[model samples]
Target: MTQLIFINLPVADLDRSIAFYEAVGATKNPMFSDETAACMVVSDVIHVMLLTHDKWRSFTDRAIPDAQVSAQMLLCLSREDKAAVDATVAQAAGAGGLPDPNSPQDYGFMYGRSYADPDGHIWEVMWMDPTAVAAGPEAFAAHDLTPA
Candidate 1:
């Protein structure tokens, strides 16, 4: 069986988070949703659990990091091509997210950009050329993922 990933994140507002993710083309899993949390189905193998702050606290002893104050996590999504990555990032930005100013890296095989959601969760949108990576790391040298 193929491995799957479920990323659980704490959200300040459940409804707002649901709207934000929906704008970016994700669907909610009604089975796991409630007033305190919702399951976002990114794909068949990927899901995100968005929990209200209070509900999230119930599941963890560690304090939830204030997204505006400090970094907590970085989620990344891969695309089939560079254009696909760009489009997705654009959609995220249009839906109240902001692009990160960090430098880009183009290893010839992979290119990526970063963005932050309304709640300050960081995400990296990336595209990779499998053939280039298959050749070797040499293909990635000096490639800037950020625009010139």
Candidate 2:
């Protein structure tokens, strides 16, 4: 069986998070959804579990850090191409997500952008050229790293 990923995120507003995710192309899985939690399907093997703060606390005793104040792990998703990466980040921004405070990345063979959800969870959308990846790190050294 193929491995699947379920990323659990604490949301300040479950409904809003659902809407935000839907706007960025995820579909809701009602079978695993409730008033306190919503299952957002990113792809066949990837799912995002949006849980209300109360519901989240029930599962873990660790304090939920204020995302705005603390750095948590960044979640990244691969896209088909650079345009796809841009489109997802644009959709996220249009849906009230905050664009990354830092500049976008463009490494000739790779491109990426990031945005913050309503609850401040950081999501990065990226695209990497398969040929470039296959070529390996030598390709990176051959190209200019400076942003255009």
Candidate 3:
């Protein structure tokens, strides 16, 4: 059975968060969305749940750390290629996210960039060459993911 990942984040504005996620290529699953929570599907196996503070509290009593100033987690999503990674970051930025909050990573075979949503949740988009990944990390000496 394939395991699925559901990253739940607390958002200040559900509507805005939904819009931002949609811009970044996540489609909202109406079947699991409501006024207090939105289930944004990134792929067949990945889903992001944007929850209101009230809704979040019902699930966990722990204080919700302000993602704006402090990062709770760095969520990453894989793209098809380097261009797709850049495109996702650009889309997030166009939707009001702060681009490149973290330093970009470029290994030629593996490229990545990040953007912070309006609530300051960071999402990293990455692309990796399948051939390079199969060869492992030792294959890249200086930004070369695959050995020629």
Candidate 4:
């Protein structure tokens, strides 16, 4: 069987989170959803479990850091092309997400943009040129990687 990923996130408002996710292209899965939790299906292999703060506390004793003020992790998703990446970011913003706080990244072969959800979880949407990828890392040799 193929391995699947389930990202469990602690949310302040279950319904709001679900709505945000749905607007960002995920669908709610009733099978694993309840009053305290909802399974957001991002793709066939990727699912996000949105848990209420109280429910999340039941799973761990650690304090839940306020995502708005803390750095936890960045979740990234790939799109079919550069346009798709940009479109997704726009959709996220229209759905109440914050646009990228950092500068945009454009590496010729790859392009990416980010947005923060209502709870401040960072999600990066990116796209890579298949031809460039097939050409291997050597194709990026001319790109500067040194710290300024």
Best by TM-score: 4
lDDT of 2 by residue, 27-95 (tens): 999999999999999999999999999999999999998876666888999999989988988899999
Query: Could you tell me which residue pairs clash in candidate 1?
Result: 106-143, 107-140
Give the residue spans of candidate 1 off by over 4 A: 136-148
Across 30-83, the per-residue lDDT of candidate 4 in tens digits comes to: 999999999999999999999999999999999998989986898999999989
For each candidate, how many residue pairs have backbone atoms clashing (under 3 Å)?
2, 0, 0, 0
Candidate 4: give the clashing pairs.
none
Tell me the tens digit of each residue's lDDT in model 1 across 1-148: 9898889899987888899898788999999899999999999999999999899889889988888668866788888898887788788888888766345556556788877778888888888888877868677665654556
Local accuracy by lDDT, each model: 0.82, 0.91, 0.90, 0.90
TM-score of each: 0.86, 0.92, 0.90, 0.94
TM-score ranking, high to low:
4, 2, 3, 1
Model 3 lDDT per residue over 1-148, tens place: 9999999999999999999999888899999999999999989999999999999999998999999899978988889999888888898899999999998988667788999999999988899889988888666665643423
TM-score of 1: 0.86
